[model samples]
Target: MPHDDVTTPSVTTEQNNQEVLDVFGKHRDLASLPVTENDMPIGLINRAIFMSQMSKPYHRELYNRKSCIAFMDKEPLVVDAAMSIEALTFKAVEYGEKALADGFIIARDGRFLGIGHGLQLMRVVADMQAEKNRQIMHSIDYASTIQRSMLRPSREALARTLDDAGLVWEPRDVVGGDFYHFAAFEDGWFAALADCTGHGVPGAFLTLISSSILTQAIEQRGPRDPGALLMAVNRGIKQMLGQLDGNDETPGSNDGMDAAFFWFDNASRRLAFAGAKSALFVLQPGDEEGEIVDGERMGVGYVDTDLDFTWQNRFVQTQPGSVVFVTTDGLIDQIGGPKEIAFGKRRIRETIRGSRHASAARINEAVLDQYRAWQGHHRRRDDLTFFCFRVQ
Candidate 1:
């Protein structure tokens, strides 16, 4: 809201009508002039009104010798020097046409400071707003870099764990709420997908917090128990967001996440899956339609959600040459196609059914192609993440 004080010069009460007219002739740029007496604002004079009256036949002869106060407008717009531009804009509007014609008086504690113009106020406000917008964009860009840094290390781990895999992570905005994770444990590897509440900056903040808590949970509890990690994440988010008191009636208590977690054990050849209003899929070799693993009906960290509840894990034994898939709801929730309905899970199921034996990478390509074709020109609904890995 900072702005420059654009005040013009003023006139003294001692100036006679003729002297005031002479001042106008000398300075053609001033559309209005403020009159002061004892360094306090007394009145104002509109250039057009004064000039028109003075130019009339015999009018100057009568009023030129009169005191300038006789020709001055008794009431005028007066503004404080320290007034904010936003408040001044409203003041300008309330004053109507006189603000543009005679302008306003800039005063400090009822004493004449200077003269202010409406046009100058507008210019200063515009410049300040532009600068503020620039600063916000710069901060968002920096945050985007930090969010991306969280992804690089996870990719390195995925390379070591899988023979073939594919990942697609797209944020509707430059920084988004959707996030994914992958890491190698001593026995096997773990992966997860989460859709935090909202999108853009707010969502990005949750992703950072969610990702960090997930890493800490994996480190402490190990990746073999995905349900425990989910429980830990639920607790961590509730604690971080100050929603742990379990008061669902709070006005802004709905902030939380929908997530799916997966753990693949090498020695046991089993996959452990846990979810909070999310799901994962397992497609075995030569199978057109695979198993759909539905998760718990409850979501994580939400108001009214049980604080002491444990997420149940569903275990599936791995099949050689099979592919496992997990995704955030962004893709399935997208509104597109001729009917303008959601690109539902059935479409996803069909896309993978056609290439059940292929590596996760090839299957990803096929899905992407169909998704693009179905999406057409529709705007993205939310942040998106889709990840798949071939079981070796």
Candidate 2:
């Protein structure tokens, strides 16, 4: 809103020094007085400038009886009453130091309106910016709460579902693209970790949608076969996004997820795995190196439009003390360290081999610590998620 209420003292150009001095004495708080002819402003008289002139030797005797016009500033900052506060502020700045300290005059349709104080206008702009910042922070905090709720579960319930499991989930922002899910089915347990396409709010939305689809696939179709579960999830995602009948002519929507899913059988001591552009790491006890099993080179909904969607499952015969680790690309793609290169798959393999005999909890901690040390002062490039479990 434009401010229009200005009632600063004004004097006629013909007003004598005695009359102007009387007006100044009554106002006391005014920094400047506008000198007008009729109802239009002709000039401005700064109180300090007038007082300094009066203090000069022989000056009062020379001009005390003359018209106030002799001491008034011939050119003053005069702004329109309808001018926006932003424009008024810029106009005020053009007057240099004096306009900021002594204030300026505002007129409406060539008639004197009021005075605008520089300090008061600045305060209004500052308050408005502060309020906007507060609102944005509030919205981000609320989104963080919602994202946390989707991943958090009771410790007792999680422990009962998996024999021994550890997770490292870190988001670059309050809400991010990485997410993990675990569920117990009829024959065994199923777990998954995924990295959605972007980060922050856009990626968070995709994570929610992908997680919900994965949950429904598990509940309705069961987790007996890892490959079938992933295929069902892919179809569900394609259908939901209306990409089932997409063709080469259609522009691709760069929305999908890279994920790994595993079904653990407690009775047979076997694990079945299926992935979409992700991988699984296995470390046998006492081994100096671990093996990496790569998944199909295709993302869930990012498959080629001309080709058929087919995923293959891999089976692992787990020993009692073996460890299995699954992760999103964020862990290996992070850039830092002395070389300023990516952490890479080789570092991950070495970390797992060193902790082959350690418990899942210890291995998870060790791997995350090494990652942080390697990252050093580099900014995070993406969301990270790692899930590790010990074979019972």
Clash-forming residue pairs, model 1: none
Which candidate comes out best when scored by TM-score? 1
In the range 90-205, model 2's lDDT, one tens digit per residue, is 78777787777867778889998777666766787678778887997788778878888888852334577766788888888888999888777557788888898899888888
Please state the error at residue 281 of candidate 2 in Å. Answer: 0.7
Tens digits of per-residue lDDT, candidate 1, 31-82, equal 8878999999989998888888888999888988787887688888788878
Instruction: Predict model 1's lDDT versus the native.
Output: 0.85
Best by lDDT: 1
The parts of candidate 2 lying over 4 Å away from their true place are: 2-123, 154-157, 242-253, 303-308
